[model samples]
Target: MRSDYLGFSCLLSAVILQATAVLAADDDVLKRGAYLMNGPVACGNCHTPVGPNGPDLSKELAGGTPFDFPEFMAFSANITPDPETGIGSWSDDQIARAIREGIRPDGTVIGPPMPIEFYRHLSDDDLKAIVAYLRHLAVVKNEVPRSTFNIPLPPNYGPPIVSQGSPSPDDKIAYGGYLVAISHCLECHTPRGSDGHLDMKRAGAGGNSFPGPWGVSVSRNITPDLEDGIGSWSDDEIKAAITTGVRKDGTHLMPPMAFGYYANITGGDLDAIVAYLRTLPPQKTTN
Candidate 1:
């Protein structure tokens, strides 16, 4: 019996080593994919809701935060890897389809809050890496409620061809940030006039109005300005906010940031976005 136990232990160790090596081989892909999920995607800021203040840290990827809209209505769902509650039962391809096509694992269409249109251009490899990383996260097993929606969250809002000034190649971090910009992060984060169109000149300068599940909130200025934009923050600070949904002063990032899907990001890639953001012209304005 002792000999048999020894054999089992040896077998387990070997399997662990092999898995570690495999993960090492795919490290770069995971890193890049992680960047795509966090910085540009900002998935966790909104999707993976936070637990009670300093209560439990185990429910990392399990999403359940309510996402409200202008009216009192809203929706939220779990994105964890739990078999019964999260995305665990679904295959990588199914998850990818949802990211790229807005189709859910059950063949139903994921509603507007998802912004599936933005991910239509992701390279297949990037998508796969995202799947791998997500599949490997700590399973929270929390049963999140179904995501409710009012079809188009924003009324009559049609984003333009290039959401951010334009798309640049190879610089995935920049591309991701651009994706965030174009994805309408600012539309809700930045304040708008009565006419309804966003005041582009003040972009990311904050003051945007929010009406959703978390409550009536205003968007913060993300520009490079020291006072308002993220200029005063360290790269790590920005990353914490983007990844864990924690804010600059140790406060949590508010609703709509969708930090859950974004938290799987590789640490390195999130840094690159900080580098890129530092280069943008700092803007100081009161939206």
Candidate 2:
């Protein structure tokens, strides 16, 4: 009887230890995730609607940004922990998959407005941290309508690539690919070719344009073009533009640049992006 009792006690103690470990891990993850989600990456830029001046802290992560441009109309969905309104019903795995792979719980692929490209670079641990933080958010009762694009070619407008998850950490190119993704460089720089695939030949040649409130704004080619891109600009110039929203010409990059919020990206991460961008072939753009 004593032997059996000892086994039972050991099992109970093991369970307690495991639970404690899980909780500790979750707490650490939540803290880090909050910083990343709210800062650098600034998921809140779109997810949390802006106020007269900036984001209304009251609506924190309760998403409802109407992103209507000449080509697309979409709204950021609520991502709080609200069981009915937010992601409260989603499993941690489901949430992690969506963040890393851009697939919804139902296996539907999300597009455009959500900026999954940048998210595809998140490490598993970072994604887990994000999931933990998401679990603890206030569940605001906002119900955003599920997005439906009315584009005549909604299906074929962008390339039909599917994000599976982050790549092997040991692979430098893969890591660079992840950084480029989370930066969403392709979303603005890579124009679609005749077959709807990103013209790899012009990967960072820029020329992508969208109608702005006052006029059309173009994303500068990120390729290493000595004449048109950071190729000629020193590292500091690129970094300044990224962190401060100022450009090489001392003019401010317009909205959708979102550096107003994305200015929080960490120095190390920004350096990594610069390093990766330098590895790309140079391509000049007039815009």
Candidate 3:
């Protein structure tokens, strides 16, 4: 009788330990997801609605924001865990597909401003982490308007949904390239056509114009063109520009650059970004 009681107690302890370990792992993943979304990824900049000052902290990721472009109006979607409007009902695979393939659960393509092309390069672990973080958001009940495009979307518009492995953290250039993609650098820097679509042929040339209270600010050419881009700027100059909002010439950058948020990026990540920028081919911007 004594032996049986001891055996039962041991089994119970083992089971509790297993459950506790699982919970710990989940917590770790959630923390990582939050860091990625709020830090380098900066998903809230677009998805969250802003007030007269800045992002309404109360509504966080509830998503009633409108991105007005020359061609059409794209409204950001509410990504909270609300079942009726948010992604609460979406399965993990469904969310992964939308992020990686730009395809919705119903087989329809998610239109521009979503930057699915860059997100497609997310590693499996990072994708899972993002989903985990999103799932844990406070279930805000906000319904966003659907996006409408004036021009016909090109056939096979987004990248192919292939399972490409992400670059290791040690590979500075490759990892930086991945970070740039997910951050949607080209979406802001690359010039858009009259129809408001990115001109891929002129990528990195940087003629895109963004109008704000500060004034009409244009993205600078980030390519390796000595006369037109950052080829002449040292790596330190580039890092300072990104993190401090001060350019090599001592001019301060305006809104939409998100330098304040980027200031939180680690030194290794900044180095990686500089390393990646050095590899871009020279492309002179007409602007």
- Candidate 2 residue lDDT tens string, 15-118: 99999998897778888887767655567767887777777778878887887765468788888988888888999988877776677788677666666655
Ranking by TM-score: 3, 2, 1
Q: Find the 10 residues in a row with the least total lDDT in model 3.
A: 153-162
Candidate with better TM-score, 1 vs 3: 3
List the candidates' TM-scores in order: 0.57, 0.78, 0.88
What RMSD does each model have against the real structure? 8.3, 4.1, 2.5
Off by over 4 Å in 3: 1-3, 154-164, 192-202, 212-215
Ranking by lDDT: 3, 2, 1
As for TM-score, the candidate ahead, 2 or 3, is 3
Best by lDDT: 3
lDDT of all predictions: 0.64, 0.73, 0.82
